[model samples]
Target: MPTTTRSESTQAALLEAARDVFAEKGYVNAKIADITGRAGRSIGSFYNYYDTKQQLLRALLERFPAQIVERARDGLSDDWAANIEAAVRAYFHTFRDYLPEMIGVFQLSMSDPDAAAWWRSQRAYGIASVLALIDAVEQDGDRIGLDHHVFASAIVSMLESYCWTWLAAGGDDVDAVFDEETAIHTLAAMWRRAMVGES
Candidate 1:
């Protein structure tokens, strides 16, 4: 029992350390030695839990929040405007909470096929939630003239690109300041207006 407890504790330390290292150095540039050093564990200990850094990334992705899936599965609220705000808040919150993982996926996906697939799956979850929202709006008797899938695609892109632009890249202009409330309100307003014709 003591051995198992130590193993679990070591694994948890490794995972947390990996997140910090990946956030600081990015996945493409991070080395196994860096992760092990951050964890204060021997290099061999890493191998016991994960064969490669890619496998560690897979583990992070596995634990990625399933909010989108849960939202889609649970159905949306009857209050369309409130729902818009709620969805936008949830999206931004997720991005903030998992900024490092998101950055790792974005940076590595460019060069790694597996990473690319993982990134796509993340987008797929957002798309699924957007589709469900659109369906709910339609069922509420609003006519969404645009192709629903395309609209959902656009909405997801807007949310994702905005988050990446401000959160990850720190926005284009150095003088511009970004905050959580403004970001959430802007995206939520856009989503609400786009779906219901007024913010």
Candidate 2:
């Protein structure tokens, strides 16, 4: 029992260390020794849990909260605008919290076809969420002319790209402070306008 507990603790430490190192040095640049040093564990110990840095990154991706954006819900109200805001807020919050892992996964996607597919899968979750909301709106007699799948894909791309640009790489204007509420509200308003033709 004690041995199992120790193993779990070591794994947990390695994960935490990887998160920090990946955030600081980035996934592409981070080394196994750096992760082990941060965890205060030997290099060999890292191998006990993960065979490579990519595997560690995959583990982190598995733990990311992708479901928040994937499973967005509509409130029991007629105001679709507010519902959009709520959904955008949910996605923004999730991305803000896991910016590092998002960056890592995105970086991996560039070099690895499997990671690219996984990235698309994550986007698919966002696409599905948007589709659900759009379907609800369409059922209420609104005529949606655009392609739902393409539109949803664009929205997800916009959110992910903008968040990565601002949250992860810092906003273009270094002097400007990051405002969470304003960012969410702005994206939601734009999305609402594009989706329902209302501001």
Candidate 3:
């Protein structure tokens, strides 16, 4: 294995420190001083890796798609239901695992055009995956009587919003608590039903 350089180590420390600070203080409120202080690095070291906190947050956000893809790769099959279930579970867990990045992107996207565009691009990535799934299903001689693009967009939106509502924003109903398995199954069932009219 290649040894990690001091520069790489410092960059990793800064990224971890930023995640912690963003989690505790919210992205908008977190300061470069806080991140550097937590990382035991100088402010100048931070500038060497990232020019702004937004750039650091973007670096964190970049990991999200890869994590989702890796997690969703397991248990994939010709069966659409199984694929949908795996994808839903992967998304839910990844959202929870990377809550800081999700929170940072959502908060910054409101005022930052670049962040907003990044957020949209992330959603588009999900949409594209769904569209590919649709293509595979159609190639298997199944007909979905809807516009493919709209259907894929709706599926991605549902997954994104539901994950945000439950995992990030807390559940919508205070009295209704859902376990992880239940939530994943419900979302997967909805997606599978919408696609092929059976769960």
Give the number of the best model, judged by TM-score. Answer: 3
Tens digits of per-residue lDDT for model 2 on 1-199?
3456888989999999998998899999999999999999999999998988888887877744454745345333577767788787777777777777888988899999988987787677778878988998899888678999999999988988888898887678767777888888899989978976875
Candidate 3 wrongly placed segments (more than 4 Å): none
- Residue 193 displacement (Å), model 3: 1.2
Q: Assess each prediction's global lDDT (C-alpha) against the native.
A: 0.81, 0.82, 0.88
The true-versus-predicted C-alpha distance at residue 43 of model 3, in Å, is 0.8
Find the number of clashing residue pairs for candidate 1. 0
What is the C-alpha lDDT profile of model 1 across 1-199, one tens digit per residue?
3456888889998889989998899888899999899999999999999988888887876745585445423444768777777778777777777888778888888888987887777787778778887887888888888788888889998988988898888787777677789878888888878876874
For each candidate in turn, the TM-score is 0.88, 0.86, 0.96
User: Which predicted model would earn the best lDDT?
Assistant: 3
Inter-residue clash pairs, candidate 1: none
Error of 2 at 129 (Å): 0.9
* lDDT assessment of candidate 2: 0.82
Name the candidate, 1 or 2, with the larger TM-score value.
1
Q: For model 1, what is the alpha-carbon lDDT of residue 154?
A: 93
**lDDT for each residue of candidate 3 in 37-98, tens digit (9 for 90 to 100):** 99999999999989899999989888788788788888688787799899998888889999
